[model samples]
Target: MAEMRLIKKGAEAELYLTDWMGLKAVLKRRIKKGYRNPDLDSYVRGSRTSNEAKLLSEARRLGVPTPVVYSVDKRNCEIVMSYIDAPPLKRFVDGMDPEGLALTFSRVGEMVGRLHRGGIVHGDLTTSNIIPYSGLLYLIDFGLGEHSSDIESRGVDIHLMRRALESSHHEVSSEAYLSFIEGYRGVMGDLSDPVLRRVDAIRRRGRYVDVNHRKEA
Candidate 1:
């Protein structure tokens, strides 16, 4: 095995770019936590790695662009997957003009809708998790994704994306989000209502709303 170069380190995992079995791949290795019980920590890491790998393949099958898993080592709490060469959306979204930015966000929303329709909820939905590839948007980083048919989970997914946009690209956030909802509705059809209503309910709960969201323009 060629030495895997560390690309990022996160709370749960470390990302490495490597050549696995002569194939270029991104390896996600769950970080070991010393504070937790050994047995519990291993179980948590292994399960999350397995879950993320499963969700990555499943989401791709549902026509949601995501990396292809090459192999997994449960003992090591690592997953080797195809690497995407595109930059995350957060790096580019702001450079686009209003119309262009909204158009891109609409595609992001549609992808999320497609995932939801397939019974998956991306627990972490943010600009940083999206990539532009082959003239389309690809969703990445399924560390927080799971299989869920619940409306609340689905609402929370979209909610997170909207909040991400608001904070990351404040200028085009609202307009882009409206476009996102349009694309989501287009794919969700009749099912969009319940989830959207749940999103409003979540906002009303007050936990997701910060002073910035409450302030008038």
Candidate 2:
């Protein structure tokens, strides 16, 4: 095992880029929390690492282009996966032209739709979690993922992406957002009415209007 350089640090896990078994790989290690009791903390970490691996396997089985899992150490509360050598979608779209932006959004939507259709919901669907390489879009980070056949879960996934775009990429927010939906709907034909309603609610809430004024007396 070579020195693991920190690639990403998050609330639940820290990602490191290192050589595993003589191949380049990503190592996601659960961080220890001092606030919680030792026993409970260990259990939570173990469970999370296991769940992430299971979800990734499920997504990959359904043909989602995620990193392939190489190994897992439940005791260490860590997982090793293939490293994707591509810029995150956030960086990729930062300099994209109109056509490139549209293509990127469409592809993101399609991938999400496929995952939802296969009964998976990526709890976090931000551009930062996606990579654009070789004209292919790959979704990463299953830490918050769950299996859900519910349309609302799927809608929330898309809604999160829209919100992320609004806050992060303000310039092309309108057009890029529309392209994302086009691809999502193209796959999840006639999405449940409830899902659309929830998406509308997400939009309304995103306006950041006074919550008290919005509620009917």
Candidate 3:
């Protein structure tokens, strides 16, 4: 086993930086759960690890720039993939020129549309999942990804991206998000319209909750 240093530990998996075949790689290992039966836990973790590997591979085959999956060990619930050496889009957004940000945002939108067209839903579309390297965008972390042809699922994908922008970079995020929409509309067109509508509905729901809380306070 190659020595791997832990990078980040989440509820489900621990991300490690490791060396593989002379290239830098990421090792995602599902943490063992004692709360569930061992057999059930193993089944769930193995299934998720396998599913993500297939989804990522398909994304690459379809021309989406996701990390190249190196290997999957179902027994261990581990997946190894190429480690992106670039900062995530969220980090770069702070230092991006207006023009660069606009271009990046457009590229992100186009990438998302392409994924949708290919019948894949990223499930999680946060800026952190987008890595900007060598002036290109690479989508990462397909932990929640799935194959779906439903327009609502695709709309939810866009809505999640919008929510991520609002939460991470409010003012500039809005313009950048609009640029994403512009790019998405260029390709996905009316297919994304339902998702845009859902974005509005989600925002209203949030505002309603906020207003009620304020009134009570």
Candidate 4:
């Protein structure tokens, strides 16, 4: 076993930077939740750990850039995977010129299109979960992702992305989103139409809810 140094400690898991068979790796161990029954907690952690590993591998098979999964330990509720040595896209895209921002987000859109075309929906699609490495945008943290090809699922993915950009990259959100739509259409072509329409529907639904809340207030 290699010496592991703790890197990130999130609410659900802990990340350790370590080495595996001469390869730099990250070990993600799901923490046991005290609020749940011991048996339930164990089962949940094991299943999620296994599922995330499977999703990571599946995304790679779909030709999307992601960290190569090295190993999975269901017993320990942990996954050992290749570590991407790049800042998250959230920080990487900050202060980028318009042309560069458009290019970067278009690639991101293409990657998401590939995933959706392959029947995968990233439930938590955010720039923080993406890393730009080796001239490719690598998506990470599939713990919330699942296999789904429905229009609603794909629309939610794009909707979440748009909201993320609006909240985190507002300065360039409009242009970035347009570029994303362009690349998404380039990949999905006719299939992209329905999903894009659904995104607009979802946005309108959000606005409706917000309007109701404000009216009540």
Best by lDDT: 4
TM-score of 4: 0.90
Question: Which pairs of residues collide in candidate 3?
Answer: none
Residue range 1-217, candidate 3, lDDT tens digits: 5889999887889999998898899999998999999989988898889888999999988778988899899889999999988777888787788898888899899998899889999989999889888767899878688999786678778878988888898868888998999998888887777777766656567455342344533
TM-score of each: 0.90, 0.86, 0.85, 0.90
lDDT computed for candidate 3: 0.85
**Model 4: CA > 4 A from native:** 35-40, 210-217
TM-score of 1: 0.90
Error of 4 at 90 (Å): 0.6
What lDDT is reached at residue 129 by model 4? 92
lDDT of 1 at 147: 96
Q: Candidate 4 has which clashing residue pairs, if any?
A: none
lDDT of 4 by residue, 1-217 (tens): 6999999998899999999999999999999999999999998898888889999999999999888999999999999999998789899677799899889889889999999999999888999999988888899989878889999999999999999999998888899999999989988889999999899778778455342344533
Q: Which residue segments of model 1 deviate by more than 4 Å?
A: 35-40, 206-217
Each model's lDDT: 0.88, 0.83, 0.85, 0.90
Q: With candidate 2 superimposed using the best TM-score fit, by how many Å does residue 95's alpha carbon deviate from the native?
A: 1.3
